[model samples]
Target: MSVRAAELPSRDALQQLVRAKAGTAKVHHLVPVHPALAPLLPDGGLRPGAAYSVTGGALLLTLLAEPSAAGSWCGVVGVPELGAEAARSAGVALDRIALVPQPGERWLSVVAALAEVLPVVAVRPAGRVRDADAARLAARLRERSCVLLVCGDWPRVEARLAVDEARWEGLGEGHGYLSGRDVVVSVATRSTATPRHVRLVLPDATGRLSAKAPGTGPVELRAVG
Candidate 1:
């Protein structure tokens, strides 16, 4: 008996299943991640065929900003709340950043499609991403020399960038508007035996990422009556 098309499964579902059954392959060549994050990575950047999980929602914009400014096309899927102003402020070239905020039930298909054209694609999985699907995406990424930045959890990731601690520098006991923040970044990779880490200000008072360690000196925050 023949099964109905709806029962057969969609293209995304098949890809995920196929990936789960596929074997791993080696990928060479790395793309420059954000300048601040580069030093923390063993390869100093993202590998074409690997997946990465990162904490800090704001970090998504900052991380993509790097390659985007360098003329690489970038896309964001599944993060509807991400704002254009924030992305622009973070150094992402507005013209090169593609935003798909919502893709409904076709999130995976959308990601797959973007991966084909964009060199960098940042996606926050709307739901649990099966290992099979993740693997398929990774394999595709490697083939296309693309960087897949996953905002949420994914199976068998190459590395994970997590924020251990974050404290604002401009907050006062009674006054001052929010200014800069100091954050500690922890890095872990499945391929490496050990992990790397760093501490820096994502956006200091000047509204720019500090290339070096964060400033320690305390400063007064403006008070308004």
Candidate 2:
């Protein structure tokens, strides 16, 4: 199935459907992440019922890949530029993912409704979020044991991940095409005073994430306009 913007469901309808489908299955405390990204997380995986602030679309896709592959439902809200091909290439199971490209004034409601059934939901707020609204959502997430990945700022988050540096490879003398990106990702948790950094091939030549090998020699990089 393709990942495309879907029509929003009514809150009552969505809740009833979720209740019917959810049954009484228990949710795991953590969701699996890419092996390369395990070390960066405080729990070695994404903790259920918690919020994480993430920067970069690639990184968000990376986070969803493992969970979706494991048969978990995922959703993305308010990201109109989310490329379906890129998501597929990044290993996301498009059949199990929902895309809400534009939530407009109902962004929060859409996210909340999705959280009822989706184990993992990502959203880029369309406007500034009020602290009270965030707090209410946080409570709902905890109650449902759902994981929320916010692309933009949140009033509170279990952890924050940001790409500190990035460089593309596979170009030589302006001849070869861009193939992969190497990035320095910084992970910060509320419990830690300083953030931890990890270098990774965000998307290697094969379009999958991997830890950057140690002691790799640096090559001259040309700035791209």
Candidate 3:
């Protein structure tokens, strides 16, 4: 197996990659994962050419939903486990998100093609994407200024965001639709700074984003015992 990316770059180089851009201008009414998260990010929204890795395919799809819901074209490459219903619930315009049934060794080429036309491109991590390939991808990403969210470990990628596993609760004796599991998904991780942790209540049946417990204080995760 190849070495982990954390092993290749020196501490200084990693730090340089993770540092937020200086002299950021303020944008009015920006949408981020949450209120607290908005200030932590320089763009005030999901940054283009950056990668956000989730624990599994479900979360990966969820992360891609927002951009798709906003009428952006999303290209999903090498993902076979995606469900139609879940994709809809996540707010991805099913019509707009193209699913490549099979993307074999042509991962980089596919990514290159999608990055030019699609606004948000999601690739399921499978094989090795070398530092050189990643460099080319990053260059193209910069040129296109499109958002690229990958679903696995990428050492060559300059920035990354890792969402922590969520805690669930508040189910009473087989109540509600799910398996009595009230999962509280975490919105945590920073690409160019220290990691941040926040709580986001899952959207309702109508695909609305809201908090389970309403309050003015810091949001906390609540789950069943």
Candidate 4:
């Protein structure tokens, strides 16, 4: 589904429409993330109605892939550069995904609207966002039981995932093309004083995220401040 900025509805209207479509049921369970990433999250997955800040677009798509494959509707806002082919290759269900590439100044409203009905919503802020705006949206997310994935920074978030180090594989002696990337993913949450780090092939040879094999090499761990 495509949402044009000109046709975007008010938060109230969107909430009503969502209620009509999905009723008042609240999802209290955690949404599934890729197995390779589960260890980084305190809940072992994404908690419903919570917001998370992610550093990379590939990582954001990876977060959505598992939930989308589990039959959840996912939405992307203000990310015109998101490639559908890449999303699909990352294991996201294209058929069940909605794209709002340009929400303009109303990106927050667009996100809040999508969060009401979509189980997973990913967005890249078009500009600086106020803490008040983020707080309001947080309330909406809680009410709707939606999981928000912010590509950029947010005033408040349950957790933050970042790629501290990355190395592309499949380029040997400058003869082969790049096939995959080994990244050190770091997760910081309010509950932990220190961020947890894990190494994985963000997009393995098959274009899927997977844990790096044991004894592959030493993984460098760094603190994220």
Best prediction by lDDT: 2
For model 2, residues 73-161, the per-residue Cα lDDT tens digits are: 99999999998887888899999999999899999999999998899999999989999999999988977888999999899999999
Model 1: pairs clashing at backbone N, Cα or C within 3 Å: none
Clashes of 2: 0
Q: What's the candidate order when arranged by decreasing TM-score?
A: 2, 4, 1, 3
Per-residue lDDT value at 57 in model 3: 52
Error of 3 at 133 (Å): 0.4
lDDT of all predictions = 0.79, 0.87, 0.61, 0.86
- How large an RMSD does model 2 have? 14.2
Total clashing pairs for each candidate: 0, 0, 5, 0
Rank order (by lDDT, best first): 2, 4, 1, 3
The TM-score of candidate 4 is 0.81
- On the 0 to 100 scale, the lDDT of residue 112 in model 3 is 88
Please identify which of the two predictions, 1 or 4, would achieve the higher TM-score against the true structure. Answer: 4
Judge candidate 2 against the unseen true structure and give its global Cα lDDT, from 0 to 1: 0.87
Candidate 1, residue 99: how far the Cα is off, in Å: 0.6
Q: For candidate 4, lDDT tens digit of each residue in 1-225?
A: 787887888899999999767544443368998887888898798988889999887898899899999999999999898878878999999999999998998998899889889989999999989999989999899888899999988888999999988988766553666678888999999999999999888787777888866223334456989
- Per-prediction TM-score to the true structure, in the order listed: 0.80, 0.82, 0.67, 0.81
lDDT (Cα, tens digit) per residue for candidate 3, span 114-158: 999886778876697788888888878766766777778775543
